[model samples]
Target: MPTAQATTTTNITSTAIDQKTVPTTKDGLPTILNHWDCRSSQHPTPVIMIHGTFSRQLSQIDVTQMLHDRGYCVFGIDAGHNDNLYTLIKPEYYGTAHVDETTDQVNAFIEKVKRKTGAKKVDLIGHSQGGLIIRNRITRYGGKDVRIAMMLAGTHQGTTLMGASKIVEEAMPHLFPIIAAPL
Candidate 1:
């Protein structure tokens, strides 16, 4: 079982995990777990890890654990399709969620982390589609709470699917136009 520490910030009490015992990589870094916390940490700012397309917070466990071991409070969330049914049945579709919706969720999570840690700003790390979500939140959704944003393998320009869709658009002319419009 994971070890947890209870912290009282304002009127709220949250359990943060003591990940010292969690498994680590060959380089000696803890593996991040969902909702794991280290609130007693002295670090002023927290770190948020966002998973890529079709993935949940667990996807970036290694990175999160690394940050925690480095003395930063880390958090993660399952944005877009967070429902259990959808996550279990068809996780890939989770990436299909609109950027606006995911960005809103990211913004909210950032606020919550800041309130809990009493930090002025938080750092963000995103992977794949998760990177795009962070970008949208910071650039479009007024996410001034973030101090630094790092993206890994993100779809910043667009997805490669767009190129394939263009080919189909030319081949089918009318049929593919409507089908590939979104891509």
Candidate 2:
């Protein structure tokens, strides 16, 4: 014989935990490099990271963790999202937006990060397109809050695509600008 009893379940919400958010992209998706609450007291200066074209902030997790391990506060933003529906499928490719829009997003993210950590200035590290955006922000938009900026293999001369682009350039000189310029 089994006895059945009606039981009531109550849902309780706790306010003890604090919730915080940092903008990582135009779509506001959560990224692997955003650590709003992990601001290090020992390392007062905060470091911000931006990924290269056709990449996401998550690709910079290694850098973020390295900085964090060294007691530095690190945050990141994945700007420049393609307006096409493909973004919905592969959101990781977030650096396809127009240059103006991309730079604007980076500037806004930098301002937001400065406000969050209460840091007047921040160190910026960018790769490829990210670096271009940083340069544009600093030179064109007056990077008033940038303490230092570093660009990794982001030369305007163009990327070799790990040597593949060089091959393409030699094979088809006419298609160099057509195929490589976009990258």
Candidate 3:
């Protein structure tokens, strides 16, 4: 049986599995059956990796390689190469918020991955704010249809710096140049 390990942050609890005695998969990939079910015989489902602010898809290549070796497909999405949260949220002119745009991009990526792999669901892994986007999709947008979600160093709740910046942005729209410069 897989033991459960839970981590709590910002009033939300997420789980991990610890299965010390189980045999690994035929490919020797560690099995956490409680966390994810193997569909190795099925055509591989693409894994999506989301990177943090100013980071690129290339940053996740090593991780993608590992997943590929384990019999999974991998892909990454770039979040417009913005330096800070403020700029990403308020682009030159925007119809969607930063998070909304990023999530839309992810949703589109999922469709593309599904079409390419001929799989029903894709796994999602996100780093930093990328993880927040994953959570938003899962919890708010009903993305439980996704196979699995892994978040590394994600900021699920609004950060202190974000709160401060929102206040400043509301108070001084004219200083957006200065406020957004170092963001």
Candidate 4:
């Protein structure tokens, strides 16, 4: 039972557990469990951070912290989650979803953020496959709430797995399913 507390920041609602602070949406798994309400926040525009390959929202935790420290509202979600053998072994497995699926997740997270923060637009920041997923979300479905987008180690051009996918496609088409499950 973690208690919600705001630490050294304004308008940040986080759970204080083991001296660690984190925010999340209720009934957590894919969405965060932070119960923070930013309706009266100083910064009207919120920033959404997206993590990279085989990564979770924790990968962008530092960025979120930095943004909150600067009085900027920030939010993150576990995108690219998939149900497969990998997740059965490690429930924390993230960024394992296909590009199309991941984009859908991102899109949903954006809508949630908009509703929570009551902001008309949000900034997008992503790493690795997260960058590609952001592009897919914006391209496939119009980025209505996206104000600005920054991609780190963006794979918009392609992915390092392209060669691997090619090699596996030629070597063993049957095993492609194994390498193809994750980015």
Best by TM-score: 4
Candidate 1 minimal-lDDT segment of 10 residues: 27-36
Per-residue lDDT of candidate 1, residues 1-183 (tens digit): 999999866543434544455575443333453233456447656788887766666556656755666677777777776544445677544555667888888788888887766777888899998889888987876667778899998898777564776687678988985675443
What is residue 40's positional error in candidate 3, in angstroms?
Answer: 5.1
Best by lDDT: 2
Residue-level lDDT of model 4, residues 75-147, one tens digit each, is 7777777777667677675877778888888898888888776778988889888888888888987878788
lDDT value for model 2: 0.73
**Candidates by TM-score, descending order:** 4, 2, 1, 3
Better of 3 and 4 by TM-score: 4
List per-prediction Cα lDDT, in the order shown: 0.70, 0.73, 0.61, 0.72
Model 3: ten consecutive residues of lowest lDDT: 27-36
Off by over 4 Å in 4: 1-36, 39-42, 161-183
Stretches off by above 4 angstroms in model 1 are: 1-37, 40-42, 82-93, 161-183
User: What residue runs in model 3 are displaced by over 4 Å at the alpha carbon?
Assistant: 1-43, 81-97, 159-177
**Measured by TM-score, how close is model 2 to the native structure?**
0.67
Which parts of model 2 are misplaced by more than 4 Å?
A: 1-32, 84-89, 158-183
Write down the TM-score for model 1.
0.64
lDDT of 4 at 136: 87
Residue-level lDDT of model 3, residues 112-131, one tens digit each, is: 66676567777888877778
